[model samples]
Target: MPDSSTHPTISSAFPLNVLIQGEGFPILCLHGHPGSGRSMSVFTNALSLRFKTLAPDLRGYGRSQTVQNFEMPDHLIDLEALLDRHQIDQCLILGWSLGGILALELALRQLKRVSGLILVATAARPWGNHPPVTWQDNLYTGLASVFNRLNPGWRWNIDTFGQRSLYRYLIQQHTPETYQYLAREAMDAYLQTSRQATQALYKALNQGYNRLADLPKIQCPCLVLAGAGDRHITPASSQETADHLPNAEWRCYPNTAHLFPWEMPNQVLKDICDWIERNPEVISFKKPEVRSRGQ
Candidate 1:
């Protein structure tokens, strides 16, 4: 909502809307489910102090036009197209929740383009090991109900105010009408991509795209950050992801939930910036040579 319209728009396989802030090496940040690139603007604001940040609303979410047959492959292709538009040959990727999974997939498929990877509160088998049935059910039901009402032909106009106004109206404090409007906007997009999204979810669930098995294929330094109290993904899941990546540093925040970035922005920012600073040469960042007994 911060006037994202001020950013550039590019034509790819789909119409792509992106926000680029600051000027330095690129650090692309991806947001979680049912959310847009604007959701991770907190990170962009922080990282923009040092690095150029590219945040795009994934396909089927926010300002990005929905891809009719949405899937992991579609997302990867969209990302590739976006990069091609920008003429960015290589960059770092930071993804949260669902976005993290996509980031990993992109890194796996295009190793040379990715310099480093950062995953937060993301798991390989997210649907298979969800937090609770009730929560998941509630989310899907709410989304489905909302999607049913939108006109499939309506297109979202990319703008900065849309992000700010909507976030304030929904995420901050919302009345019934506010919820209704947000639901309407969301559902309109959802109805268009529901079938493909559902199919992709089913395949991802059944195939078990194990981040663990795919870890060894990653050629960049990786950082895994998890919230200790995240029911959706336990510390053990983070451990499993870290174990898979040969060059991964893992950390768990003791008093955090699944929403670490929202709850403890400054702390998360420090950790990420510190890691990036230390790893000036991508995977070249080294852990301390000595180990502490307390650690």
Candidate 2:
């Protein structure tokens, strides 16, 4: 097993905490909303054996410093700074949920720097045409508004039936042991996240963020993984994303929900590894000269 280490990149606004492991072609792992770099360990740990993995706790999530008001572009800037600081000219990106959206945007912004994309349980445009704000959204937002003002670290108790039900919805297929383990970890990451950050992200998504038109512009190889039982981001939505992408391979896992990575870690890992092996071009991708800002 490859050992992992957490390194903090100091920035003027806030420090970005990254978990790095292994030593080979770089693979940047981006976690979903309300998740931390720790949330991506299941994939990072396994991929680390063959590729260098850099999983960062995005600003306002996990160990990273919390910011009061920020937008999605802030994350993009952080990612760009991270790559520049590490001096990584090119790398493959594995993005889960919200991270997947960011990955797409990054690939678009840095076409040459991003060799390929692995999008899991996410969509380029999650809300499609009409974005609905559910009761759950209200609940979290209301609670966050109250709790965040008092204390950002304060978290809602997971023992409640409502929280339990939400967990079940997020993770439908899981063994008793796996359920217990993932539930605890997921809740911790979720609760630890800045409430303001969640609100901002939700607001951004609700504004009808759609990338269907831009998908065709992303020419890099892509592997889009979806969970058939995912209610949060339906498999159909994922399929639509794949359909629009110029070069993409789609795979949907049966009997799994949004948290399929935790439910079926081995299978997900195998699929990713197998895909990489089959697509050797992803490994031998040539790096282009770094362009200066505004080039």
Query: Which of the numbered candidates is closest to the native, going by highest TM-score?
Result: 2
lDDT by residue (69-176, candidate 1, tens digit) is 655566777787888888887889999877888888888777777889999888654532343345544554454343324422112311222222323212222233
Clashing pairs in 2: none
Question: Global lDDT of each model?
Answer: 0.66, 0.77
Tens-place lDDT digits, model 2, residues 151-201: 332335332222334454566663544444454456667777997678768
Looking at candidate 2, the ten consecutive residues that score lowest on lDDT are 1-10
Off by over 4 Å in 1: 1-12, 125-199, 283-295
Q: What TM-score does prediction 1 earn? A: 0.70
Measured over all alpha carbons after superposition, the RMSD of each candidate to the real structure, in angstroms, is: 11.9, 8.5
**In model 1, which residue pairs have backbone atoms overlapping below 3 Å?**
1-160, 1-163, 1-164, 3-160, 4-160, 147-187
